[model samples]
Target: METNLTYEAAYKELTEIAQEIENESVSVDVLADKVKRASELIEFCQTKLRATETEVNKIIKQMENQ
Candidate 1:
């Protein structure tokens, strides 16, 4: 199984890829690779966000039960 990437790391990677894509120096041919990487990073970020939301909900439920 793959280790979970920290939100910070994933966000940083996403930002870097966006910046690269924004740069005019980047060749059109490489855009496809960058897009693929960006998609994967997005999925990773979404999974992390969902996990966090579930944890927060659990905490809230526990507090309400007290």
Candidate 2:
């Protein structure tokens, strides 16, 4: 897992992996590796979304109170 991957990058990679798998284009030799990478990207994307949602909510609350 890369520490510096942005949400967009991870999401793009995940999408590509899904397409490759769906199209049956990935070779068996590297299928496991691609699946693992996809899992990591999914987790990273989920975490990023949650953090963004929390930050946005906090900012909205601040604005409402001001």
lDDT of 2 by residue, 1-66 (tens): 778899988999999999999999999999999999999899899999999999999999999999
Give the worst 10-residue stretch by lDDT in candidate 1: 1-10
- Candidate 1, residues 2-62: lDDT per residue as tens digits? 3767778988988998998887656899988888888988988898899999999999999
Judged by whole-model lDDT over C-alpha atoms, candidate 1 comes out at: 0.85
lDDT of 2 at 14: 95
Model 2 quality (TM-score):
0.95
Q: Predicted candidate 2: what Cα RMSD to the true structure?
A: 0.7
TM-score of each: 0.85, 0.95
Model 1 lDDT, residue 21, Cα: 80
